[model samples]
Target: MRLTRVTTAELDRLEFHAVRSGEHAKVAAQLLELANQVDAGSEISRAELFVRAGEQWEFTQEYERACAAYQRAIDDGAATVVDARALRAGALLHLDEIGQAYAEFERLEADEPSSLQTYLHVAESLYAHDDLAGAERWATEGARLFLDQVGDPYVDDLLQELLRIRFRIRADLGLAEDALDRCTDTD
Candidate 1:
């Protein structure tokens, strides 16, 4: 479908699922090429093209190229706040700019409190840096937010992961009793 008539968010959703399932790389090249297509001398489409290319590069772990593409999108001002921040954060994380990635996630969380993914990323980064206490806090907050407020489609997956992380954090902090209590059934 032509981009002008098609919703960008819808296309982005499709691309997200494709990348998640590892099937979008080939289609991604085509999307990237189309991103540069200009209609009636407008640069809008070109900006979107770069953003999509950046997203594809990110999915493939080409961190530097992904960041460049995302930077182009920002310079073009075609990316929405949520998309831009998320992509930039992912690229920064891939590049091992953990502090920058954490800051990005913090900004995203402030704007979107229901963004479990950002919380999860923050927690994972903190954990990687051996900040178990901070990671535990983030993981607990994410689990509670998802389970209580959103009940999102990813709840089960997030919950399982949270459980694991919580256990690890507790164990590492020498709270084995607390950790075991959580892991066991209360019924």
Candidate 2:
């Protein structure tokens, strides 16, 4: 394995090709191997390499590996600290590490999420775990807090995710849809 760091853009391009070829699992494994050799530094390239590897591992349904990659990213103190921790929690959930995952989630919630991404991930994980109530709580609150950021496309997209998860959770709980539910889709 090469010790020199690779650019995140290059990693993304590899992911693009891997996905396009329907061979992302193979590429994800390879990226993770590279990530293993990278320094746990906050430098842009190093940090992104770890996070990107985690994301690809997630795509491949390798939750244990994904958790490791995300943890590495977090240890590196990557700029997107919350995002990395949130992902690690989700990966832990997928690994059936319920107590650990919930502990992380509670910590994240107590700290208060500044980004809708955290809410979306936590909510989606809860929803997947059949915790509709928990999912609804996080998703609805996240959507409510970020509702005013419509003009900012990135926040809008994340807000939509939170809204979508909340909508699904509510639907699963047999709850009535409200005006806010309409935001899940234009129609």
- Cα lDDT of all candidates, in order? 0.65, 0.78
RMSD of each: 6.2, 3.0
Tens-digit per-residue lDDT, 1-187, candidate 1: 4543335674677687776788656656666656555453443456666677776776787788777777776677654422556567667877888888768767766766455555665676577667788778777776666665434546656566666776677678787555433642233
lDDT tens digits, residue span 18-124, model 2: 87997766887777677667654424345566677787888888888889888887787656634777888889988899999888888778878787777888888
lDDT of 1: 0.65
- Give the TM-score of each candidate: 0.56, 0.82
Error of 2 at 177 (Å): 3.0
lDDT of 1 at 4: 38
Error of 2 at 16 (Å): 0.6
Looking at model 2, residue 78 earns an lDDT score of 51
What is the TM-score of candidate 2? Answer: 0.82
